[model samples]
Target: MANIVIIGGGPAGYESAYVADSLGASVTLIDYDAPGGACVHYDCVPSKAFIASSEVVSNTRHADDLGIRMPSPDEITVDAPQVYNRVKELARAQLADVTAGLAKTKVTVVRGRGRLLATEEHGSHPVEITPEGEPAYTVEADVVLLATGASPRVLPGAEPDGERILNWRQVYDLPELPSKLIIIGSGVTGAEFANAYTEMGVEVTLIASRDRVLPHEDGDAARLLEDSFTRRGMTILTHGRAKTVQNTGDGVRVELADGRVIEGSHCLMTVGSVPNTTDLGIEEAGVEVDDGGFIKVDRVSRTSVSGVYAAGDVTGVLMLASVAAMQGRIAMWHALGEAVAPLQLKTVSSNIFTHPEIATVGIGEKTIDDRDMDVRSVTMPLRTNARAKMAELDDGFVKLYARPTTGVVIGGVVVAPHASELIMPITLAVRQRLTVQQIASTFTIYPSISGSISEAARRLIEHDDLD
Candidate 1:
């Protein structure tokens, strides 16, 4: 059996180990933290736990809207400590489950950081493992997979002190909720935090360098989210970039480039992420990284070196955890001479966890317009759907895209409560190249939000005929 060594125990590395092991390869997975990576330990799992609690708070506050009586509006309160504890607990449980699975799969787990050694140093073995407080060792590998993941991007002046100023990962460690929270960068991360905190009754201010929040998302979806944030009394600073963050005795101050200074009890930075590729001896091993320090990998996750491969956020190719796992599996399969398929980015679905979630799948409008592709689209409001009305959900919509002539679904966007759940059918349609007629003809439960999807698909078919 071939020996496969994977660096970094994030989704990509851990998943790659399992795949290779199942295929009869001897695999060793190495990382400092528990196996699940940042998605479980920091970003996805923990944040979603907080979001879920906030959702309950939101639902209770709006219970009166559904003719359900509560004791009083003022009496409803969210315990911040409990919320933090819950997030931590869930993250720990998830990490435990992942590590347990890795153990069961017979993949050797190395508890330390792994780095590519100099070609000469790795005369026989290409990788070196340095465990904390332990002697260093080398691994003889038939193939080396790099899944080092990424870290939160920090501005030069806006350094996180982990107290008054924070990164997304540090927010979960707060002892108590801030009276006023300032979030820098209004991308998906910033917007989700803003939405979650607003629901949990924390005053929030969003700093957006762009004209609107989630500038990369669909225009209509961004506008809807902005409107919701405004309705919830969250302050927004647009077209202004955050220059620096400084602790001011009791709180923190954010200085904007436009001669504006904002004060908040705490600030959360959601700018972006930097790949964890530095000091890994990648260049020494003949692996190529881009100008941004991200590993340059092909669709199958092969690095510049024939026996070396890379995946996940380290590759700077779609930073989603699911994509990381898929890329890792593809890398191992390709290396093991097993059947493999290159990644098709357009088929991937991503979700933003906000009060009214935003989920998108397949090609977006910008891509189609840039490619000059002929397509037709139709959008149906969730408010118009029976289930949405019954649940008192009046915001958001379902938008579908299809080829003008063939009626093949190409992409879709959903904005609604549990929009993530509703986007799967649309994602399947896009991935399977299902026609608008086929989607419309599929059976949908009566009075469901999913019915809106089918209804939108039917409308797309009608509009295509008219064009």
Candidate 2:
């Protein structure tokens, strides 16, 4: 049996280890913290736990809109410490669950910092493990999977102080709500936090370097989200790049590149992320990295070195947790003499967890533009759906793209309540190359938001007929 040693128990590392073990390989998983990685322990699970509480605030506040009497706005209060406690509790529970699963799978879980000691021309390497509060040791492995993940990118002048100034990972420890928050960056991370805080009654100002929020998303979806944010009293600063952040006596001041200054009780730097490829001896092990320090890997997740593989954020592919897991699995399968499929990025689905989530899959507008593909698209607004009207939600739409000639679904985007769930059918349609007619013929629940997807597909067919 092949012995696999996986580094950094994030989604990439742990998932890879599990897959390798299931494939009859002896696996060792090494991570300094819990096995679930940052996604489960810090970013995804914890943030969503906080968002869940904030969502309660929003729902209670909006209950009256649905003809249900809610407590007076003045009588209602959000206990931030309680919310933060819940976030931590949930994270700990999840970490425990992941640890238990690893134990059940018989994957050896080593708690420590793992580094590559040396690599042979082919097969096996010596990995050094430095355990916290324990002696350092070494292990031999036939294959070394590097899934070290990435850390929050810190700007030169806007470093996180873990107090008034924070990054996404550090935001969970906030004991109380900020009176006024200045979020620097209008990406997915920034937008989600802005939505959560605003719902929790915090004054939020979002600074966007791009002309609009979620510049990478569908333009219509971005505009809808921006409009929703504004309606909720969020102050959005577009084309404003943060030049520096200075800690004031009581708060902080953010200076924009254009000489504009914004002050707030707290500042969140949602800038970006850097791969955790430093000092782990990646280069010394004969692995090649890109200019940005992300390890270079092929579709099969193979690095330049024969026995070394890289996955997840370290490879700079799609940074979604799901994609990371897939990459890890592919790496293990390809390394072993097993059936494997190279990563197909086009089949990946991504979601932004805001008030009204944005989920998408397959080719997008930019892809269409760049490829100059002959396709047609139709959008159906959620307001037209009976369920949305009943739920008093009118801030989303479903958009589908299809080949005009074959009517095959190529891509889709959903912006609605639980858009992440609503996009799955469209995702299957795209991945399986289902035609618009096939999707339209499928049964949809009456008066449901997902019906909009089929309605959009039908509209595309009608548009095609006109041409």
Candidate 3:
């Protein structure tokens, strides 16, 4: 059996471990934390748990709108401590589940920080593992996969104090919810937290450098979310760039580049993320990295050095957990001499978890316009759907893009509650290169938000027939 050693226990590492072991490879996984890495311990899992709690709070507040007469809706309040506890509990449970799954596999789990040692003359790679408060040891492997994930980017003069001024990872440690929360950056992380806190009854101020939030996402989706945030009393400061943040012992103050100062009970910074590639012996291993310190890898996840592969946020390819897992699997498949296809980034689907979620797959409208491709597009508003009107949701739409002549579905965007779930069929259509007629002919439950996706595809088919 081939010997494999993977560094970093995130989705990339563990998922690859499973694949390698199942493929008759002896795998050793070195992880800094639990098997799930930062996603489970700090980011994705815990944050989603917090969002779920906030969504409940939001739904209860709007119960009257749904015609559910309640005795005292105003009396509903979020227990901040309880919410944090629950988030932590959910993260722990996920970690336990991941650890248990690894135990069932033959892959050996090592707790430590791992770095690449100089390649041996026999062509076997050696990985030096340094366990915290323990002596360092080296493990030789026929193949080595680097999956060290990324960390939250910290701005100059705005370091997280873990008290008042905070980063996304530090929010769960908050003792009490702030009366007013100031979120810096209007990207996915920033928008998600701003929406969650606002729903949880905290007055939120979102600072966006762009004209609208989620500048990289679909324009219509961003506009709908921005409007929803404003209607819910969340203050959005567009075209505002935060220069510095100061924790004044009690509250936090943020200074903008355009000579503006904003104060709030707490400040959360969601600027971006930096790949955790420092001191991993990239130069020693002769691995090439980009100017931003991200390891340069091709679609097959091969680094500059042969037998040494990289995946996940370390490779800076999309940075989603699902993408990380796929990259990891591809690397193992290639290394183990299994048939593998290169990663197709265009077919990858993504979602922004906001109040009304925005999910997208395949090509975007901007890409079509930039390339001036011959594409036909159609949009169906959720307000026209029977289920949406019955649920009192009027703020989202399903958009489909197809080839003008062949009518094959190339891309789609959905903005609505549970858009993540609703985008699956559209994602399948894009991935399989299914035609508009195929999606239109597929039966979607009547009165469902997903029905809008089919309706949009039907409109595209009709447009194609007209031509």
Candidate 4:
């Protein structure tokens, strides 16, 4: 059996460990934290738990609109402490579940920080492991997979003190919801927290360096989200760039480059992330990294050096946990000499978990326009959908793209409540190369938001037929 050493316990690490063990390899998984990595412990799981609570609060506040009148909808308030407690509980439970699952496997889990020692002459690599409060040791491996994840990028002047000024991870430690929150960087992380907190009754001010929030997402979806945020009483300052942030003992103050000062009870910096590859000895091991310090790997997850592979956020492919897991599995399959296909980024589906979630798959409008691809597209508004009307959700849409000549489904975008759930069929269609006619012919339940997907597909077919 090949001896494999996988570093980083996040989605990429643990998922690959399972794959390597299943392939009858001796796998040793090393991580400084628990099995689930930052996604489970700090970023994705905890934040989504909080968002779920905020959604409940929002539903209660809007109960009267649905004719489910409560005694006092206006007085509905979020129990911040209870909500945070549940978030922590959920994260811990998930971590325990992952640990239990891994226990059944032959994979050896180690709690330590791992770095590549050097590439040996005998085609074996040595990894130096340093466990917390313990001495350092070395493990020899036939193959080394680097799944070390990324960390939140901190600004020079806006360092997170874990009190008034915070990063995405530090918000969980907050004692209570801030009275007023100022969010810097209007990217996905910034927009999500701003949306959740605004729904939870905190005054939210979002600072965007670009012309609009979610500058990287679908333009139509971003505009609709911005409108929804505005309706929910959130302040959006477009073209506003944070020069510096100062925590004034009790609150935080932000100075904008355009000569504006904003003050809030708390500040969240959602600038970006940096890969955790600095101290991993990638340089010493002859693993190549990009200009941004991210590991440079082929689609098969193979690094520059033979017998060395990289995956997940460290590879800088897609930062989503699902992508990380996929990359990790690919790395193991390739290493174990199993039948494996190169990672197809075009078929990857991703979701932004906002109030009205944005889910997308395959080719997008920007790519189509940039490359001048010959494609037909259709957009179906949710306002016209029966289920959306029943649910009193009026602000979202479904868009489908297809080849004008062959009618094959190339990509899709869904903007609605639980769009993440609705994007699966579209993702399947994209991955399977199903045509628009096939999607239109698929059975869909009436009075459902998913019907909009088929409707959009049907419209694409009609347009193609006309052409």
Candidate 5:
């Protein structure tokens, strides 16, 4: 049996450790925190927990409009501390469940910071981790999986003081929500927080360097998001270049490159992320890192080093929780010399947790623009869908892009309630390259949100308009 040492407790490390342990490999999972990794402990789970509460509060405010009467409090109250506690409780419980399962396997979860040390005078290097207690325990194994996640990007001038200006990860501890929030970046994370907080009654201003929100998404989808955000009272400044953020006595003032200034109670720097690769001894271990320090990996998740492998955000390939999990699994199979499939991002589904949440898969306008592929798209507004009208939701639609000749779907987008769920069928179709006729033929529930998906596909078949 091969002994596998998985570093970092993030999704990539924990998932691969679980997989390797199940495959009868002795696994040692090393990290400073518990097994749930960043996604569960700090990122995905906890944030979603907060979002759930905020969503409830916002939806309740709109209950009467839904023909449902909600009990009205003279002055609605928000117990932020209690809400935060619940978020932590949910995150902790989920982590405990994952840790419990690792017990039966020969998987050891060690708490420490690991480094790759020079091997003995005769062999390859081994991972050296300094345990957090007296007389640290050192465990060495043959295979090493690197899943150290990424950290929120802190710009040169705009460092997260953790007070006035903060990263998305630090917002969970905020006792009082921002009265007016200025999110400095119109990326996925930026838009998500803007939408979520705005729904929770925060006055949100989305500052973007690009012309519109979600510049990387389909043009129609981007336009829709921009329109929706504007309708929701979001102050969107296109071509906005935030220079410096100064903490004012009352709030914070952001100086733009164009001499324009804006102020807000709080600022979220959703700029980007930097892979956590420094000081891990990655370079010393012979692993090739990109100029930006992200570990260089192939489609199969193999780094330059043979015995060592890297996955997830560290690889810098589409930093999503789902992508991280898949990379982890692929790294293990390839390392173990078992059957493994190369990473196929063509089918990877992504979602922006915004107000009219945008979920997409396969390729989009960005792909078409860069690759210069001749594809046809059919964009149908949800305003025309009976289900959307009945639900009183007029803010989203389904768009499908296909290869005109073969009628095979190459990409698609969905925006609406449960858009994350609604986009799955389109993602599957794109991944499998299913024909527009195939999607149109599928039985869709009457007056359902997903019916728009069928409508979009059918339109593509009928129009034959390739733009």
Candidate 6:
């Protein structure tokens, strides 16, 4: 049995540790925090729970339009703390389950700061870990999996104090709701919180450096989201980069590059992430890292230094929690000489948890823009469908792209309420390379949002009428 040492107890590290332990390997998992990682304790579960409360508020407000009356007097309002408490409760429950699973697998959890100790005088080559306040655990392991995750990147001028100014993870701590919230950097995380908070009755102003929100998403989809958010009283300022963020006596002030300034009760920055790869003695171990401080790893997640591997946000792989988990699993399998497939980024699916959500997978329009592939596509509006009419949803659609010559599905985009769930069928098609004809033939409930999936594929199959 080989000894496995994993650093960072986030989704990536804990998942891999459990897998390694199940495979009969002796494992030691080290994390400064609890076993659930940032995703559980701060990022994923907590954020989604807060978003769920926002969903409730939105649904309550829209109930009358759906002919479903809520008889609560004086109109329903937000309870930020209770909502936040609910988020914490859910996170705790999920963390409990995850920790329970790790226990069952017999994975040893070490709580402390873990640093690599050099075996040689030059401080080069294989590693021995020096844990905080404990004996120097000289781990002579068959393999060391580096699953250390990342943290929210703080732009130089916009530092967060976790009070009036904060990042995504710190928002839940506010005792009360901000009367006005100014959100800078309208990327995926930024857009998501903006939408959720606005729905929960916070006046939100979104500041973006680009021309549109979610600049990384499909152009049309981004435009649609901008329109939708605007309709919901969200003030969007594209091309307005935040130059300086300062706390005023009443609230926070953001001076933009364009000379205009805005103020709000709180400023939340969601610029992006920085990989947590430094100070782990990776460089001393001869492992290569990119200029951006992300560890360099091969398709199989192997680093330049043998017996050392890295995965997840630290490697700068796709930053999704799911992708991080998969990379961690693949790393363990490879290091243990089990069956493994080289990482294929193209097939991974990710979703934005915005109202009228966006989810996608496989070959994208960006990749196909310059190629000579025989691609055909169809965009079918949800408003035109039976289910959408029943639900009274004004925004969303199913867009599918396929290889015309081979009839194989290549890419797809779904924009709908619960679009995340609806995109599963399209994801399966693209991953399996199933043709538009096959997707069209699949059965779907007539009064369901997923019917748009088949309808969009059918439209692509009959392209002559589209023009």
After superposition, which runs of candidate 6 have C-alpha atoms over 4 Å from their true positions? 71-74, 118-135, 370-373, 464-467
Task: Give candidate 4 misplaced runs (Cα > 4 Å).
Answer: 71-73, 464-467
- Candidate 3 lDDT over residue span 259-352, tens digit each: 8999999999999999998879888889999988899999999999999999999888899999999999999999999999999998899998
TM-score of each: 0.97, 0.97, 0.98, 0.98, 0.94, 0.95
What TM-score should be assigned to candidate 4?
Answer: 0.98
Model 4, CA-based lDDT: 0.91
Instruction: Give all candidate RMSDs, comma-separated.
Output: 1.5, 1.4, 1.2, 1.1, 2.4, 2.4
Q: On lDDT, who's better, 1 or 3?
A: 3
TM-score of 6: 0.95
Query: Candidate 5 local accuracy as lDDT?
Result: 0.83
Q: Considering only N, C-alpha and C atoms within 3 Å, which residue pairs clash in candidate 5?
A: none
Residue 349, candidate 1: C-alpha displacement in angstroms: 0.4
Error of 5 at 298 (Å): 0.5
Q: Tell me model 2's lDDT, rounded to 2 decimals.
A: 0.90
Per-residue alpha-carbon lDDT of candidate 1 for residues 1-467, written as tens digits (9 for 90 to 100): 89888989999999999999999999989898778888999988999999999899899989999899985756878888889999999999999999889879979998888888755544333688888789998877878999989999999999999999999999977889999999999998999999999988899999999899999999889999999999989999999898889998789999999999999999999999999987788977888889999999999999888788999999999899999999999999999999888999999999999979999999888888789988788889988999999999998999998887788889999999898888899889988998988988899999899999999987876773633
* Candidate 3 lowest-lDDT run of ten: 458-467
Please give the CA lDDT of all the candidate structures: 0.90, 0.90, 0.91, 0.91, 0.83, 0.84
Better of 2 and 4 by lDDT: 4
